[model samples]
Target: MTLLALELLIMAAPDCKGNSVRGACGYGEFGRDINDGEVSGVSSRLWKNGAGCGACYQVRCKIPPHCNEEGVYVVATDYGEGDGTDFIFSPKAYGRMARPGPEFQLYSFGVVDVEYQRVPCRYGGYNLVYKIHEKSYNPHYLAVLILYVGGVNDILAVEFWQEDCKGVETHEKSVWSGS
Candidate 1:
């Protein structure tokens, strides 16, 4: 919820494409079309070691004439680093920041000063979904990607509970043995 000033750049990445699974966060198909192809790659400060994935932000460029007041809403789906830019928006999302015309003029800037803040992702009619990665093997390796999370809290960790695993109940909280 903290609004911060940052610099953003435009990039032509496949993250906005509907079938590309190539990203640092490994979001797979979810990264493709989340937020209606309005996705961005954040710098290391926001990346938080893949925790930034699926996070949403409302970004507005500072250009009074070329940029709109609402700017664009985008989901962080990948990791990108630039000279001083904190965000690298896909072409689709970057173009949305333009007002009516002058899209080319805005793009000519390449990098622009922008104000951004963490925003809740609202996917209408979509509930939270977890997609098992293709590399996951039952009872051996598990890699699950959570999608459609619409809160401000960053996902820190995931716990898998098994009935066979013994756990200790402390203060009504279950603490698994080896966790």
Candidate 2:
């Protein structure tokens, strides 16, 4: 069996425009801010569908209501396909779909839009899909740490940290997976 795990971190300033209280931390080019209601609804649906193995596995975390601090929200999705399963993690939709096996499993990160789509970001020859406005340095980033799984007895682990460099803050990670 093959399992694919993905972890993503989305950061935003508390003072950022839009509805920060509800997880919408910044504004977009169209003058639209992150819509907390929309993100939560979509995330809930994704988790609901992800919990069942007959289809796919999915999970999401949104900004907490009591969190008044400006920072990043980390969202992680762990997808596993049995020996013949096929799973598709659509970065654009911030969701995943799969057949009844463990052959095709993928993980990704990004800021989701009101429509639950990923905004494009450039990385190592591929586009990092996100759901937030691409223009502003909202610091919303999606990183694919580990994409491999050994056998059925394997476990995946992921961790993150923030670093200050040249007046800029960026996230770092230490990921490990084994059977």
Candidate 3:
């Protein structure tokens, strides 16, 4: 038998905006839903070359009644309020991560404590996947978002592939509460 990965504990907040504008990360465009593998932002200050831009993470609710076995992978898309909160998930992400309840209860979860971990990304069941965020198509050239996965070309390659709309796999569970 194989042992599963161990997750780290972190704090998160709910951000209504998911894909508002072109992220400060210098990659990806707006109109993308903040469902799985999508983070509203993490504060531009935290925005590094490729770390905060498209870093993949699995965040789970730490509190009961909202606790879940499997969590969702949220990708860092843009930047948000610079505070103790590490990542601010979009409403879609929040709805999935928050306690299992009505839409209001899910949305009501302004903030919460969650267990998170950096995980290897799986796109379309492929270890390596590419995203066409812009019309400027380029196969040789990749975006900085790939750096967030530790310079791995196997997870997310932010590039324009001429009408290729893509995303990651998710359990739909969504994260953090007050500290």
The lDDT per prediction is 0.75, 0.24, 0.47
What would the per-residue lDDT of candidate 3 be over residues 95-150, giving only the tens digit for each residue? 56654665356445566666666665444454433343342247543322232233
Deviation in angstroms for 72 in model 3?
2.1
Residue 143: error of model 3 in Å? 8.4
Give the top-scoring candidate (TM-score).
1
**Model 1 clashing-pair count:** 0
TM-score (all chains, Cα) for each model: 0.83, 0.16, 0.55
- Cα displacement (angstroms), candidate 3, residue 150, comes to 9.5
Error of 1 at 48 (Å): 1.1
Q: Is candidate 1 or candidate 2 better by lDDT?
A: 1
Compared with the true structure, the alpha-carbon lDDT of candidate 2 equals 0.24
* Candidate 2 residue-wise lDDT at 53: 12
Off by over 4 Å in 1: 14-19, 125-127, 164-179
- Alpha carbon deviation, residue 63, candidate 1 (Å): 0.6
- Model 3, position 8: C-alpha lDDT score: 25
